[model samples]
Target: MKPENAIEVRDLKKSFKVYFDKGNSLKEKAIHKKRNRYEIREVLKGISFEVKKGEAIGLIGHNGCGKSTTLKLLTKIIYPDSGSIDMCGRVSSLIELGAGFHPDMSGRENIYTNAAIFGLSKKEIDERLDDIIRFSELEEYIDNPVRTYSSGMYMRLAFSVAINVNAEILLIDEILAVGDVNFQEKCFDKLKDIKRAGTTIVIVSHSLDQVERICDRSYWIDEGEIRAEGDPISVHEAYLTAMNQSMQERLEKEDAEVMEQHKKLGQARLMPVFCSDIAERKGTFDVEFSDIKALNSIGEKKRTFHSGEAVRLRFAYKNPNHVPQANIKFSLYRDDGILVYENNYEFATGKVLDLKDEGEVNVEFPTFGYAKGTYLLNAVMYPPGGGEVFDEINNVFKITVFSEERAMGVYLLENHWEEA
Candidate 1:
């Protein structure tokens, strides 16, 4: 236990004994012991990590991957079957919002009670009560019974108490996503302040963006073990790669019959990559592609298409202020970044589309005559004349074109074979 190390966990392991066919009736209960089928499920297997003072660490993994269990062990909410955790500072947990609150107590009373449990004295809690209430934004409801508070209200109060308790180590478990966007931003700002003030924080979250935003270092836990640990960006990228493969395998196993049929039809899998940095929205109005899909000749949404087949690029954009006229541009690029086709809405159709405040847009291509290769989509929106880009997507949506029925070049043109 070094002076500057807030937490150091060593060889941590936890497991549960799960039993099936435990009888409900008394007679069956008597024989249940002999008939019971039990298995040991290892939830955390020899995981070890450390958090230094003033350092923010993120734990990211799939659901049921022992992330919450590790937090519990760190907070002493649950004991590990083996291994040890060393801590040098008072800890505060935002694991379960209002977990220690007496439901009948008023929000104001719960604040004091919770803070006190976090080792705050009466004087300390009193000094911090006003700030907690102010940050929660529940001034009027602070006196109301906590049972009557909405989930959001309850979480706000809980987070307020946890953050204000002045604990040196904060264990946050995905609770910062409680409120709306404004409040979430506020919470992140507060976390930044806390980090600057030298509070060691451990956050477990599914949002990679949140992890990358707040964490200096991150650990990726998988199947009760530390799969990867390093800087947030690299850890997150590795985790995503693993998760993507896992999802593909699961999907294939679950829907083998359907996938086989598609395969037999020469259809390729569609993989979409979302690039958040490329989307540029300057003004109040915004344009971003949502639910972009490719439909086959039969109007079924698919990821792959055969040459000379009808493929429609169906997508929707958000325009809260209903910008009446915006030039829509979509470009098709080869997998290796060579531009294959580019077109503008007005240039291709000779007129602009009637803008809706929020609606779907369907662009149908009569025949997809591309070569047998993968193509990526980049959709852009510009204010009518086209100098300023309102929004642009760089090679995100993907479509695979198979050449079973058409030529091997970029264009799938129609021609007649005649004796000349």
Candidate 2:
């Protein structure tokens, strides 16, 4: 390891044996020996990186991408199959929080045991005991058996002990989600303080925003290899782009298979490419929606849009009965099921839609005035006066809005400030 580096990893590799049809009992194992076949699944493939003292680096990737495995290797919870890892100081890890905790033991007692596992001396633990208890906000329950503690309480106790260890190096793995939102914020603030105090930190997390805020650099691992490593923001942007492209390809393949199935059944079903699986369909089917799409100003299919960007919805319907007139309703909802906006074609234009055997209707929002978040969409067709329902699809499409400005609430209000 270089003198200036707090930690160094060189060509680290690890793999696990994934068994197939393995038996647990001795008798069953003996009788089905041949069924105990397994495969060597390589998780980390010759990955290498270094961190300077006081520097924080984040490992990011989709699940099963070996980032967690790498953390385990650094903490020595698991051994690497090959290569080397060198560290400079005592390490404290939030990975597998409460791993050494005894459920039957009192929370206060478990704190001493957990801190001891981090190589803290009895005197050192005694010095920090009160601080840990205070941070956990569980002083009242500190003497209670951990078995009686809620999951959040247990996590709080464990996190409190680990964070107060003041080790030279901290390894965290998705444990920042512990406790309620307020506690989570407090934990973040504590981490920032730790970083400022010059503790080398390594984090494995799916929350890219957290990584961007705390880490000096990021490594994007994929398929057992480090695909990209650099500034967190740039690395994450590349990672997201690749992931979205892969998802699009997978969705297209699945849509093709569904189309083939529909053809064989001699039925025209909504294309999976346009309709979400969670969409709910109802009504008499007098006029069924054939396809629906969220589009951009250029009429190109799009599900994600920036705040204040033009958004359009195109609805295609099949009216076998040639219903003369119908009212068209469109609704938008936030992810939390809050209705954000609702309108109808008849109400807006003062005329019901004239139906044909097959036709398309388009609704355009010159500027999509919404905050950054996901929203669901609903489309409905009914009689002019809303006596009978023709067709209604709830959550037929999902729209995602992004904004550069940081503000609160569902709608993005347009405003300007003048100094007085």
Candidate 3:
């Protein structure tokens, strides 16, 4: 290990044996040996990284991406198949809280038992016992049997004991959701204090915002390897972009399958091409929306966009009756039910659509001036003068806007500041 580094990992590799259906009893195992067949699943593929002393880093990836496995190796809870991990100081982990607790033991007794697992001496645990109990806010029930405590209480006690250990290195998994929101905030503040005290911290979490607030650096792990590592915001932006692309591909494939199924069934009307399974629909069947998608400047489908980026809504409709004239309206509403933008084609251009057998329309926005938040989309087609509602799809789609700037309100306006 480098002298300046608190943790050094070299070409780490690990795998596990995933077994097929196998018998539990000895007699059944002997009779059906073939049922024990298994396959080797490689979780970490020669990944390497180092953490400087007193620096906090986060491991982020989708589930089953070997991030948790890497943390387990760091804690020595699991052995790596091929690689070396070096640590410069004593380690403590919040991976499995209450691992050494006995259900019948009192909360106070379990605190000592859990602290002992971190190699604390009897005198050392005695000194921290009061602090731990106080931090857990369980003084009233400290002497009660842990089995009688609620799930939140139990977790609070475990977390208090672990955090008070004051180890030189702390490895935390996704245990921040242990208690209520208030307690969770308290834990976050404690972590910040620990960082200021120069303790080396490594976290594995799916909450990107948490990582951004706490970690000095972030490593993006994917498919058993390190895909990117650097500043939290940049790395997370790349990770989210890749994830969005993957989702787009999946949606396209599923849409194609749905179209094929409709053709096979000879359905009179095809289902909405891009509407989510839970999307609500209401229409008179005289004119029905067959497809609706939110796209970017280059005509690529996307549900997420940066605030001020160009956005366009592309929709296709079928008019079996060939209605002479119709009006189209699209509205955007924030998740809290506040309307952001709503406009009709007739009002904007003094023209209404001359309906035909089938057609597609593109509504373009050069700059989507929405703040950073999710907005619900609604599409409506009705008579030119607004009589009977021909069709209306509530929540036809959800558009998410992201912004790097720090500001408030519903609109992302263009402005500049200068000294007078």
Highest TM-score, which number?
Answer: 2
- Please, what are the lDDT tens digits per residue for candidate 3 over residues 1-420? 678999999999999988898678898789888887889999999889999999999999989999999999999989999999999998999998987999999998999899999889999999999999999999999999999999999999999989998988999999898799999999999999999999999999998888999999999999899999999999988887777666556656765676576566665544454665446777686887878888999888877787898998987888888888888899999999999889988988888788888988889999998987889999899888878788888887677777755568999788999999
Q: 202-231, model 1: which lDDT tens digit per residue?
A: 999988789889999999999999999999
Which model, 1 or 2, shows the larger lDDT? 2
lDDT of 1: 0.80
Q: Lowest summed-lDDT stretch of 10 residues in model 2?
A: 265-274
Q: Which ten residues in a row have the lowest lDDT in candidate 1?
A: 271-280
Q: What local distance difference test score does each model get?
A: 0.80, 0.88, 0.88
RMSD of every prediction:
16.0, 3.6, 4.0
Q: Which stretches of candidate 1 lie over 4 Å from their true place?
A: 22-30, 258-420
Candidate 2: tens digits of C-alpha lDDT, residues 1-420: 798899999999999999887788898788988878889999998999999999999999999999999999999989999999999998989887786899899999999999998889999999999999999999899999999999999999999999999999999999899999999999999999999999999999998899998999999999889999999999988887676666656655665675466566554454334566578888898888888888888887777777898988888988998788888899999999999999998878987788989999888899999997889999888898767788888988677776655568999899899999
TM for candidate 2 is 0.85
